[model samples]
Structures are given as C-alpha cells and as structure tokens.
Target: MGFCNSCGRPIVKEDYGTNKDGSLNDEFCCDCYQNGEYTEPDITLEEMIVRKTKEMMAKNDRLPETHATAITATFIPGLKRWNPEFQDDYKTL
Candidate 1:
C-alpha cells in the first residue's frame, strides 16, 4: 500500500488514480487525481491542510481539531504534490 501524493491518504490498488491513458497512477488516490490531473489543481498546500484537517475531525469525532490540523500540516508537505523537488516531475507528465 502507498499514500496519495496529493492528499496523503492511504491507498491500495483499487484506490489508485488514473493517468491520461487510463493506466493506474500509483502515486495518488482517485479522489485527488484523475486523467493525469489533480482534482483540485488550484488548491494550495495550506488549503489542503485545512480541508484534510476538517475531514479528519469529521470522520473521527473524538479527534481534536488542533490535532487533526497538526497531523495534516506535518504530513501533507512531504507528499509528492507539495514537495518542491517533485513539482517538476509532474509538470512533464
């Protein structure tokens, strides 16, 4: 199993994104990627962190909002979509 490059969500084969050719992308999840493009290409890292934190809190009612935000902030930057070195790689795709 791998994590989505965009959302940092855990992903299996069935959760894999698709490329423009309809091949499995492996680097992202279906919700964050499709047809070789980000589902929310205009979203910034900060926005994603906020969104994921809210989603996390909603999914786990016991989870504190601060904790959810902290987790997503820490995890999302390391993802391929947000990492500077990986940015160029996606541009050529």
Candidate 2:
C-alpha cells in the first residue's frame, strides 16, 4: 500500500484517485483527487493541515486536537500537491 500524495492517507487499489482519462492514479486517494485534479485545488498547505487535523480528531476520537494538528503540519508539506518542486508539475497536469 502507498500513501495519498495529498492527504497522506493509506491507499489501496480501491482508494486510488482517477486520472482525467479514468485510469487509476496511484499517487493520491479518491477524496483528495479526481479527474486528474485536486478536489480542493484552491486549498493551501496551511488550510489542508487545519482541515486534516480536524478530520483526524473527529475520526479517531482518542486523538487530541494538538496531536492531530502536529501530525498534519509535519507531513502535509511533503505531499506532492504542496511541495514546491512538484506543485508546478502537478498543476500543469
């Protein structure tokens, strides 16, 4: 299994995103990408971190808000969508 390039969620075949041509895109998860585009293309890394942190806490009730935020902040920037080097290529696709 690989992780989603956007949300860092674990991805299996079923969770893979779709390309514009409808082929499976192994780099991302369905929720974060579709039709070869980000579901929330306008979202910035900071916004993503905040959103994921909230979602993480909500989904895993035992996780604290601070920990969730920390986790997301630590990893989200390394994602293909947010990483500066990959951002240009990702958008062009």
Candidate 3:
C-alpha cells in the first residue's frame, strides 16, 4: 500500500497524487493532503523536511544562517527550470 509522504502513514488507495512527470504519487493520501500535510512527488523525504523547515523559519522571521542551512546550489540549475523564482534573473522578495 502507498504511504503518506509527510507522516509516513499508510495512504488510502485512492488518495495518491500526481507525480512531477504525471505519474501517480503513491505517497500522500487525500486525508493528509486535505489536513494540511505536506504533499509532493518531486522532492524526496529528506528534501521535503528541509524545505518545510526553511519555510517555517521564513514564516517566523528566523531564517537560519548560511552554515545552519546547507544551500543545495546544485539544485538551482534544475530547480530554475520548473520554479523560475529560483533563477537569479527572477525578482523575488
């Protein structure tokens, strides 16, 4: 059976989301998605946690120092393709 990406619980058979490439996510269930649980098919388990932590920190106005949060520079080259905001040319706050 599939499992929830955020909580790692068994996902209901019908709750799988779509993958980045359009395949079935087979990770998160609908209940989790509807319950504000993190859901994604592109990022991995660890990546999701890190991203969520960063988001939390930003929301709380406590962004961690550079050394505290490892910047995955290698991701920029690929992430920029899907998320333009990550591009240097893009203007974001």
Q: Rate the local accuracy (lDDT) of all candidates.
A: 0.93, 0.90, 0.48
Clashes of 1: 0
TM per model? 0.89, 0.83, 0.28
Better of 2 and 3 by lDDT: 2
All models, RMSD in angstroms: 1.6, 2.2, 11.6
- Number of backbone clashes in candidate 3: 0
lDDT of 1: 0.93
Give the number of the best model, judged by TM-score: 1
Q: Ten-residue segment with the worst summed lDDT in candidate 1?
A: 84-93
Best by lDDT: 1
| Tens digits of lDDT, candidate 2, 44-70 | 888889888988998999998888888
Model 3 steric clash pairs: none
User: Model 3 residue 63 lDDT?
Assistant: 57
Clashing pairs in 1: none
Candidate 2, poorest ten consecutive residues by summed lDDT: 84-93
- Look at candidate 2 and tell me the lDDT of residue 89: 91
Error at 41, model 1, angstroms: 0.9
